[model samples]
Target: MTELRHRGPAETDLQAADDFRGLDKDGAPDGDAHSDSEAKGDTGLPDVPVPPDDTPQVLNKALSGLSSRWKNWWVRGILTLAMISFFFFIIYLGPMVLMMIVLCVQIKCFQEIITIGYSVYHSYHLPWFRTLSWYFLLCVNYFFYGETVTDYFFTLVQREEPLRILSKYHRFISFALYLTGFCMFVLSLVKKHYRLQFYMFGWTHVTLLIVVTQSHLIIHNLFEGMIWFIVPISCVICNDIMAYMFGFFFGRTPLIKLSPKKTWEGFVGGFFSTVVFGILLSYVMAGYRYFVCPVEFNSDSNSFTVDCQPSELFQLQEYPLPAVLQSLTGWATVHMYPFQIHSIALSAFASIVGPFGGFFASGFKRAFKIKDFANTIPGHGGIMDRFDCQYLMATFVNVYIASFIRGPNPSKVIQQLLALRLDQQLQIFNSLKAHLTERGLLPANEVAA
Candidate 1:
């Protein structure tokens, strides 16, 4: 009996030992297998996260995000409008106040430029002193000699009043300018691996940016002849509205890879609508006080502005044509176009390049993997981000017109028949631009008279 019991217990112990070893060997391998399955994406689950016929909330979530973004846009727009209103209030009720406001806005704009540059090409170090000096130079060049610089360009091709003097001083002036510029470049290399070229480029861009933005605004205000500011702003707000509506409904094909949301359909639709509205708006404004003929002369000698007698004959000191062309300013055409080519080129540029400016900014955002430029606006980003395209658009439009069209380039038939002076012709050219930019905008006359 004792022998049989001992044998039975020994058999039981062997069975238990085998079971323990088997588990030890299988545990690690099983774990390894599970990990491998995970790595291989073998979820052993359904292909779709939710059924193809899932609840609306799945899609609703995406829409909800979009709506939230839109909501912020509205809030920002209202605030911006309110701020603009106050600015106008001061402009009319307080011209002095307008000066301060413009200065502040200009400075903030400069800050944005520097900040953006630093962000993108972070490798460069632009000292504060350089930036400040650049700003000072820009201010002097733009504000003090705004009209003079413009005249210089428009009349550059004209026979010089002092050709002999220019010839006499040409070499000396060239050497002086070259020496000064060279010194600046050499000084730029003073810092460790200093980037003088970039420094100059940055400064030049800043100067041009400020000049273009402010000068155009000033000229626009002058052209509109309005102390009431709503005229220009109407275009901006209307454009944003039209762009959004059109883009939402017809944004089928992506306008660009950087801004996938923007579509060709929206761009074309929005632009057409804006143009149609602008024409109507300009027509309505034609009868307003600000829309009066430039020759109306303010009649008041104490008027702050000079008699901006619209040039006749593309007339010059040497070729002083009859004053008959003066009547054509606002009386004949919408704006002035000294030459047709200049006007058309400007329009084409603003339409294409302007949009690309926005695209360029979008590319930058995508590179950084960010949604917006800043949280300042709900749907839009910062003022700089949102208006960067417009800034370039407005400037280029003006430059293109002033440079090419505001001259005596038109065939004699068109000039004599139309009796349109170069300046008046250019204005007509500008009218097209105005038409594009001023979709929902009120005309100067409507705001005033």
Candidate 2:
């Protein structure tokens, strides 16, 4: 009776379970299951776990025989030349293209930095972090570019009713948008991840400040003249190349602990090279009206124009040499554009202080234990790596122009007048007419009319 009970329903149910799992009562897979697992080679990772490098196959084949160090050098050198060629192409295309390139670079750089921040605190799985970061970027860009459009292309904005309204209330709208993002971030904070969320929030803001603000300044420099944009940028690039050349061969004494590869030899060589380069480049660019003239909008033609009388700075001038230089050169005076003198300051800063920006970036990478920001560029690391110094140089150039070069912009003043109500415009005109009349600058007939 006991044997019958054991062999009845209980034994049948156990057999059914084993059959469903494709295993016998001994808990071993059948022949089919074993063969399938074997065929799959279950290594617990994808076949190609990491993506292949996107380097050109021709270059890779050509460089396959070289040592790793030499290969890296050749790759970087070739790519640098390619980038310069592309840059020249864009410049030929026009300022609009250059501005577009700057905008694209700014977006890429922001992406790289924000990605690093995300990875750093990815363990917490913070919600709305990326969304909020991008939201803030859009808000900041809207505020800045809106101001630029309103200032430079006032006629275009004034003609479009919606744009005119938006231009009038741009700042308020930007603030409101930012406040919404801020509130979203505050609400997304979780109890356990409070510190991490705020850290990322601060991280996002700092990245925006560094990337967005400086790039806007670059556009501002571009509007002033192509020379202002080109000279400073070229100086930074030239200094970087010259310094690298000097350091690579003669880098015996280290310049800074943050970047051990940097050498004092490179620093000095780059400074003199950059200063000379700046002067020569500025001289050449100053002679060309297209390069020297401020970019302006034409309401009549509905296009941008760079046709203006050359400013005194762009004209040839003779200045007496200092006693020390006069004695050295045996000349009382030298002919040069005044803008060349300003180039000295621009180049000096690019070579001297611009490198510290790279060092700061180096320190940042070290803190995060990263070799480079990203692998976007095979030998150059990333766009941000190349531009770390350029942004700093842009800030310095903008400030230099503001402090010494720029005065009140008459076009901007006129634009402001045009944006005002007719009555307000008439009031300003009357006030100006009275003031000029008092100074005997206004004709009696014009004043009466």
Q: Model 1: runs farther than 4 Å from truth?
A: 1-67, 80-106, 119-185, 195-237, 292-300, 305-353, 364-379, 399-449
For all candidates in order, the CA lDDT equals 0.45, 0.84
Q: What is the lDDT of candidate 1?
A: 0.45
User: Which pairs clash (backbone N, Cα, C closer than 3 Å) in model 2?
Assistant: none
Candidate 2 residue spans exceeding 4 A from truth: 1-54, 327-330, 440-449
Question: What's the TM-score of every candidate structure?
Answer: 0.49, 0.85
lDDT of 2 at 328: 100
**Candidate 1: deviation at residue 269, Å?**
2.8
Alpha-carbon RMSD to native, per candidate: 22.6, 14.2
**Best lDDT among the predictions, by candidate number:** 2
The lDDT of model 2 is: 0.84
Cα deviation of 81, candidate 2, in Å: 0.3
